[model samples]
Target: MENEISSKSTYRLLYRVKPFLAITFLQFGFAGMDVFSKVALNQGVSNYVLVVYRHAIATAVIAPFAVILDKKVRPKMTFSIFTKLMLLSLLEPVIDQNLYYFGLKYTTATFAAAMYNILPAITFLMACVFGLEKVTLKSIHSQAKVVGTVATVAGAMLMTLVKGPVIELIWTKGRNNQGVKGGGTNIHDSIKGSLMITVGCFSWACFIILQAITLKTYPAELSLTAWICLLGTAQGTIVALVMERGKTSVWSIHWDTKFLAALYSGIVCSGLAYYIQGVVMKDRGPVFVTAFNPLSMIIVAVMSSFILAEQMYLGRVIGAIVIVAGLYFVVWGKSKEYKSGSPSTDGQMVQDKQMTDTSSDSNENSTPEVITLNVSSRGGATRDEQINRQSDQLLV
Candidate 1:
């Protein structure tokens, strides 16, 4: 963690300099979680079983906070809201985590994280269509938002199709030295892991957009998170029951390295991550919150290459840059545009009130002169002349 922020300047700015620093760190934490899980799996643990624990522990971790908030701050949990929660759990915990872990089983964590760069772009498009976000070109902020989204998306696609080195990287120093490879070739010769990660990104994107909606209806961030995990736990249990095929092994408590991995994921990545995401999204919107996908990719890539001795590619570095550049354009532009649209707000109201008063006075006074206007214009006064004529008559 100390090495995670080597530069004092980077720390002061990233941890303190920016407005959305917390959100940025949250995204980085998610990436770090993925890297750690990958390290744990190389030590020999079923990814699916690990996921089962992730949701379970995540539920426990978030449950108390949820309960307190549910009792006090969050909205009353109507069946309707609960139903939405259930649906959202399916998208996030069930599909999102499942696809991610499954993809990790088949692919490298770096590959998965790299592919996740699509999330912000997907979230932006979905939010815009859902009317949860607004995008315009009249302002630089809007332009940045749009271009950033495009850059992230384009980078994701480029990584997938660019035919870069997707090699397996085994850590020779580790007990199991056979996990690393040089190419992304699967036994099936397909980028199934990459595909699965894309699905994961897409599902998470939907989860984000829906979350914006969820917050509107149920503003209790803590409560919403707890219930979402609860629902995900239910959905995951059912799937694990069916997929593991009557084998209770997936449910059996291992409490080993794998369980610890899950615990970290549950407590930090899921529970705390949700809390942080909710808090930031309240200020930053889903687009910017999700926009840090590239940062996560960078974390995963760097951690994999040096810590795990995985092969790093020139393309990964370049693609990451492109994605980050895109994110910069989008978030900066969107925020700027939002600010630009707001400055005239107070002034506009004041000017409107003054105009209304002037019009009303003119209407009241001009009515008496309305009939005389035609005659006044013939020999009678014009709009300005009438005022002068009235003044003269009053003086006489």
Candidate 2:
């Protein structure tokens, strides 16, 4: 009896903390991707080539699975949907990713990850500008979000401006730095990299806002991912050809670190990461998924110190702390807004709840997990409601 009680308690605890754990795990995966990508870039792989190979591989791997899984729920691909996917491809896998890789080549993994902290604030600003989100000073929740945005931007600036004394690590203090390419201590390049990363973050913000818009029209996440990868692969190849003009040697990646980097990034980061992200977005929201990005910065900082022998400093520590605090504030505000029944969110939740309720009645013998899985995509289009209107109509 006691063991049964303990088991139930443990299950409850795990359920409560699952979202936090899931996002942390996702961030760790992203950190691994960053490390491997840096290794490839340091081995003289052109940023354009890396993007081309990664997206190309991702498309090949993901396309069949996406098509098979979404065959029933997948709607007809209109030209309009195709155009939006193309735009998404341009914003992310093309411009944003290229700039990010170029900047990463010039900066430490920690610095690159830290610069990503600006993305949430920039996204909020973009959302407001596009009228996707409202900013009312009357609501404490809105005010808190605004303050968090400012603090996050300030923290990023401090990280860029201040380079205090290096804080030596016990394990890496005296290690030979022969293999650590662009590993810290390059102020000029770091500054330039930081600027480039900031611009990349802005583009990433645009991608997120636009993704939210696109999800309204095309709700098949997996299919959309495949198309984006396919388009990005094509675009990246063109850019690579132009940039590496007459240097066909750059495309001939030796079966070495560069090849390994490309393999890992394509399978883990591009393909699996997209599926995981879509699942998380369906369960939580896009804002919730992005709120966890700061975790990657911390992971990269620790890994860079031990693996790459990168030196940390007091300035970075302080800036990281501030950025994390701001992230929490924004998350807190967002949560409050969600709970307070904001019309937009409330309407979405209610409409989705109705669809789930109807579907459950029709598919009475279906398992609870199936219902939850299908209903989690609540933030998306009303077409999802149509998809669920008839339980005879398969739910993917």
Q: Judged by TM-score, which candidate is best?
A: 2
lDDT of 1: 0.68
Q: How far does residue 104 in candidate 1 sit from its true spot (Å)?
A: 1.3
The residue-by-residue lDDT of candidate 2 on 1-396, one tens digit each, is 576555655654564366667777878887887887887887788889989998988999999988899897677889988888888888888898899998898888888988898787777767667655677888888887788777777777676677698787798778845456766457788878878888888888887767666665666678878888899899989988999999988898778888877787777777776666655555444566677787788788888777777777888888888888887887787666654445433124234544655686667775333323222243453323432333322322
- lDDT (C-alpha, whole model) for all candidates: 0.68, 0.73
lDDT tens digits, residues 19-107, model 1?
Answer: 46776778778877877787776666656666667877888888886787668556677887887898888998888888887777667
Each prediction's TM-score versus the true structure: 0.75, 0.82
- Model 1 regions lying over 4 Å from their true place: 1-19, 163-178, 181-183, 187-190, 253-255, 341-396
Prediction-by-prediction clash tally: 17, 0
> What's the lDDT for candidate 2?
0.73
